[model samples]
Target chain A: MDQEVINSYIPLFKDAFLLTVKIGWLGIALAFLLGIVCAFILYFKIPVAKTVVRCYVELFRNTPLLVQLFFIYYGLPAVGISISAEVCGVVGLGLLGGSYMTESIRSGLEAIPVIQTESALSLGMTNGQLFKNVILPQAFTISVPGIVANVIFLLKETSVFSAISLMDLMFTAKDLIGLYYNTMESLFLLVIFYVIMLLPVSLAGTFIEKKVRFKMFGD
Target chain B: MEPVLKIEHLNKKFDDFTVLEDINLSIAKGEVVVIVGSSGCGKSTLLRCINGLEDINDGRVLLDGETVNPGSRNLTKSREKIGMVFQSYDLFPHKTILENAILAPMKVQKRSRKEAVEEAMQLLDRVGLASRKDSYPRQLSGGQKQRVAIVRALMMNPEVLLFDEVTAALDPEMVREVLDVILDLAKQKRTMLIVTHEMSFAKAIADRILFLDGGRIIEDSDPKEFFTSPKTERAERFLRTFEYEK
Candidate 1:
């Protein structure tokens, strides 16, 4: 509320912002890797793996990330899998984000017709080369919007990682609120910081989508 | 002379629906086989099975005296001898015409980029698309894309090329340009199996015509005999519709 108090919180907010970015980005990277793997598993319909990934996607996508984080941080220890809080938060967020990513990539793949593969196979491309060289690139370009949307959504989802005391922005804001009993100031700052950070990403998503859609569909 | 490609007792189905039933056919070295039939008669499915794009329920496809099995790891290697063009141009939208033409050569055959591009350029030139080589698939006209697709197939030096209604998606004026390219390739003695509804084009270029009805080869004979004197009632009726178009 006071000018001096607000000024003093700036340095602390900067560190918390960086921490949010660190965990957010790590979660995003893991999600991206898992997204491609899960998509391929379902795309090829690889035996038992497809069913397992299907279950994983259905489970993660349908359930709230809060419950997922809670299960990993608190519930998994009951099953004798004691993961650290940081790992729990990141992995839970990654898996949740990845579930959404799988759908995105799958939709991208399906947009390409069966004729494309037929054309590739006729040219003597092995399944591996077909997936890597032909299918993946086209899927990726078509997937740009979904990928970008998932990342931006995942960035906001990282805010919930604060529940596990991950020291992210929300957790840092809560700490400051507890210290000074200035909930309005800290909460307002939290919302402002998130909006400020996410605005560029949102804009970039639209710009990239337009450029790629134009290249692919000419509209 | 040995047949370059052979299809013996090929059968294909989609779930319970039988699309192709006990089909037997073959193409000799340098022969141009044109497949013409009403839609849903399995002409496209037959070519798809020959190139290993569709898994046949029961059949043997022999390419150059070797039995070709779609399930085998070497199937991809075997497909080097088979080229296929679809009704829709399936050129990689992201790459240039030159890149699309050279991709199979560089990736499958392990040819150097320089060597593949050099050969691709010559083929593109022959197809009259060398001037548009740097353009992407989306940039080209339907006929230009089809021409580039042909050049891409030629770059693989395929022993046989399959065209599945390649001009079906093109405009009437665009059809001749693409057909001229195929005609030139045929003159050079490229073994081709073309599935077309363009009765005139098929009659012009086909050495042999296979008229299919209800998933069976209703008539297989020279273009003059098949067109002028259809052997089956189904073939005769199918030809009647083409008369108005001509």
Candidate 2:
């Protein structure tokens, strides 16, 4: 590609990178909230929720994310449920991230012994207090690294939304390619944009994993 | 004197497995009752039922003048009057010893942080762990954790305290320290029910000792008579194993 062309595309790539981050941030925030609620439901085994949660987890986790995204974006709107493609993308990613987050949080919850819950109950703590004060803090600390990794993964996964014309990093790259007919330059720019946007998050995930492991396992 | 606790026909089952069956016992006000039994004989379960930690399938658990019901949604409120220490100590690993000790009083009793910490410091001092108040459970020794747990339970100012083999997890040398603390509390006439395997400690401290086997109270008597003349073969055999340990 020409140096002049590459220089002009840098600004476009920056815009795409920012859009990717916006989608990732919103997706992760929603995922985190849903993950915590699902984790609690699974942890306490509320009513018939254990089986229902198990089915939900298995269904989402076993299926491909592309199919889920397609179903939400293409299938839902046909039935008069007309959510924006951007909202659909964020919600789809959030639900997907929540599936992974639920497993992470549940593992964290399992690492805490049942004796802790019993002790909390014996102390006469309200159920709300027990969940808020005793369980959530420990579970969050234990799940932090996994949740961070999920967020990073979800950041990369945001590229899938481009398939539905969300104007994310990949979508903008495609638009640039169509305009200039320079597929190589646009493709290379897209790769660079994703790498630049995600490298810090990847490093952050690794750093947090190390810190949590150190705190959990000692020195 | 009115009975402080009364257990009549106390039965518990986990699916088809019976943990306790036909347990009828009573403790008078200020009396110390020590339950000595083999593992899986339901001594701990019995104490748990009394404190509303475990629900009995069919039975009556009366604490003071009121009937204790674990089935009720408001059982936690009722549990404020009863405190329990587990064998594993079960201190909240995330909390410091002082925080663990004061949490119940502050949350359940609505005591001020200053008041709760003041009470906790006194209990810590009583348990010989005033210096370790800032330490987490993971930082403390097993014996120290159990002592802190005992102090934590006592901070609730419970009418009845249950110890489910609290010293069983400690080292042999450390066992005496926990026992000494319990003995001191007993001297203060704190209404206590201890589920213990340490026969010597039971023989020394129990105002009355109950020997359990196969989920039934085979023998209930004072330490002197209970040790000297066990009526049931199961109690005799159970006590015989401790003779070699001593």
Q: Listing every candidate in turn, what is its Cα RMSD in Å to the true structure after a full C-alpha superposition?
A: 2.6, 2.7
Q: Report clash pairs, candidate 1.
A: none
Q: A-chain TM-score in candidate 2?
A: 0.87
Docking class of 2: medium
Alpha-carbon runs more than 4 Å astray in model 1: A77-84, A181-184, A203-215, B13-18
lDDT (Cα, tens digit) per residue for candidate 1, span A1-219: 676777777778788888888778888889989988999889888999999999999999999999999988999999989988778877898999899999899889888878788788889988888878888888888999899999999999888878888888888899999888887778878887898779988998998888877756766
Query: Which one wins on lDDT?
Result: 1
Docking quality (DockQ) for each candidate: 0.69, 0.55
- C-alpha lDDT (0 to 100) for residue B2 of candidate 2: 81
DockQ of 2: 0.55
Model 2 C-alpha lDDT per residue in residues B1-246, reported as the tens digit of each score: 888888889999989999999999988878899998888998888888887878789978887767887877657876887888998869877778999998888877889999999989988998889999887778888899899989988888888888999888889989999999999988999989999988889989899999888898888898999998888877888788876552
How badly does each model clash, as a count of residue pairs? 0, 0
lDDT of each: 0.87, 0.85
Question: Where is model 2 chain B poorest over a 10-residue stretch in terms of lDDT?
Answer: B237-246
- TM-score for all predictions? 0.91, 0.91
True contacts kept of each: 0.85, 0.57
